[model samples]
Target: MEHSHKAILVVSFGTSYEDARKATIERIENDIIAAFPEYRIYRAWTSRMILSILKKRDQIIIPNVCEAMEQMIDDGITEVIVQPTHILDGIENHIMKDEVLSYKSCFQSISFGAPLLSGQKDAETIVHAIGKRFEYLDKNTALVLMGHGTAHQANAVYEELGQLFKDMGYPHIFLGTVESSPSVQELIQEISNYGISSRNCDSADNDLPVEKVVLAPFMIVAGDHAHNDMAGEHPESWTSRFQNAGYEAESVLKGLGAYQKIRELFVEHVQNAINNINE
Candidate 1:
């Protein structure tokens, strides 16, 4: 490997599921490595619970932000750039940023990248990226994205992103949270309104009421939230609720990190942070 004074530390909330852990989080890290080959890349998990579970069950050991930073500093890395895989500027991301900043003096320059939804056009960009994937859906289908909500004010990011999708002329797309406002009931109401509106419209023959719904996780990893809260066969899961309400519902068990364009956005954020440090 080529010796470099700068290093890139990718931080994530992490997942316990090995398949999801590989498909989403590891894929994002790999993309970052390809983008900045000159910089030594490292990964750190913010979720101590997940990390502990992985260690105990699978014999997998992953470092936290503090430990990763310590290794970088010990290796004489004078410049370090921290890129987070969080989807929003919520409490988790905020804590990650603070942790990265705590090791500032250990390096000559330390820069932290913004989360996925930080920039003005991020929402629109993400909407387009995900929208393109489900282009085959007809007017009778609704897309419901389940996000991990937060009490932090940044929770509004999900609502704003959903609005951006609507503003982009995709009204059938709905956003719901696992822990905040715009709950499942709210999503049902919104989708029901759209269904009613479609039925009332006397437009062309192609126009039809939404009788089918697709549920997906608007999260970085399709772990517990996606597997249980969003798609589990439980009566309260989003898929189950949608089915119980009369719409044929199915869940896509994948994360945003599975998308190429989405991973490119994280790479862009890392570049932006590095550019800021250079400036």
Candidate 2:
């Protein structure tokens, strides 16, 4: 319960997967601390389901925005900056904003930072980062980046980014979502239009356009969705759909947070909020 005049509350949806939590979320937090050592860093998770699961199963507790803010007030912290690790300004970000704003008067200054795909520039930077990360792939292989889609209007960001991936000098790199448009099925159709086949059949008719795909999670953490919905053996999973559609599938089981560039972008987001608070 120590007090620091300035603090950065790093907020996320949170995951119970120990390895993913460590690789993505914890690494982002560590990068934030390294970038802004002067300011104390705290953590908050918006998902009540995840929080409850962690508390009951793992015996770990992470505060939500309201609780964290109150804790800051109790500890005599004045200025506050909240930086969400979400991919877009969707339902989760909206919740964080509303809750964080409730305690505006409790701090000298309060600022909220942009999420990963905040603006055009962020998207552009992300494009190159992903391109470089998967540069090892050849023309015959497709990269299907799985994103956690939202019900909110912000869900459009995924489709927008989907278009951005097309012919942006990153060949056959596509995006799919679990919730909305540009779903894996939709991407299947799109990929079909590109003739990126996965058929390595054993029949006499072997003259097929063969291709392999690398599936990766586009979200900050490769959690349940990455393991279940995206790569799970279930017939409805993206991996199965791709396989059923006659394409070979390989899942990367990695999240955006594992990349240093993505982590650095998050740190930049925190720094941006800090600068805005000072101004």
Candidate 3:
């Protein structure tokens, strides 16, 4: 039997960190490519606005999913499967899904792969991924993760990640959102209070210096937020805020997606979605 699948579309939210974004997308694409060598892999970016801004600055070329689909057809592809590389069911994934639906009439079959972080299994995989990247400092330092929170119900997924860290036995893990609950200031206050609480609770026999902390973004790429908000030395940035609060702070520029385990999670997501296509 001849398998006539056209291509696997890997849709991402598009990152300014061009190399980093390509690496992450390629990791997932390679997995699908290896599994279905007969099917071609097409890449699509969901953030047209971001890509447009990058294009104006000569940063990146804006990718169009429709055009890519049309190209696949022109190349003699008859069946198409879109695998979104988004982390959540947010605007990016929604936009990609809508775009894929628009081409349903053109293909014999059109299916979607799953998002990176979706259900409990996905959350656990992400936690495992993050865990493998960092060893506990033993400095009683709080690890704060800044996520791109949204107004959608999926924003609650951030809390799930917080709980995952808690369940992993991390003593002090805090979740902050760039756009929603537990705002940056709120996170700073929480960290300050935690430091104060820790300092005041030390017993005479257990003398320990004020614990230093590390701030890292929970995003998929070390893009603008990671660079400007978390790691930047600006007076208003998280690193500066932590220093002003009398606690040492450092930032890890790598996002979760850059980690190998995290990359594997996306592969699992794609595999599961492809397996479930018949169901």
TM-score of 2: 0.93
Better of 1 and 3 by TM-score: 1
Better of 1 and 2 by lDDT: 1
Task: Give TM-scores for every candidate, taking all chains together and pairing residue i with residue i.
Answer: 0.97, 0.93, 0.87
- CA error at residue 194 for candidate 3, angstroms: 3.1
Tens digits of per-residue lDDT, candidate 1, 73-156, equal 888899998999998878898888888889887789988888988866888788998889987888789899999999999888
* Candidate whose lDDT is highest: 1
Candidate 3's residue-wise lDDT over 103-187, tens digit each? 7887777777778777888787777666655665664667778888888888888876887787886547778887887687887
Cα-based RMSD of candidate 2: 4.3
lDDT of each: 0.89, 0.87, 0.74
lDDT of 2: 0.87
Candidate 2's displacement at residue 133, Å, is 1.0
Q: How well does candidate 3 match the true structure in TM-score terms?
A: 0.87
**Which candidate number would show the highest TM-score if scored against the true structure?**
1
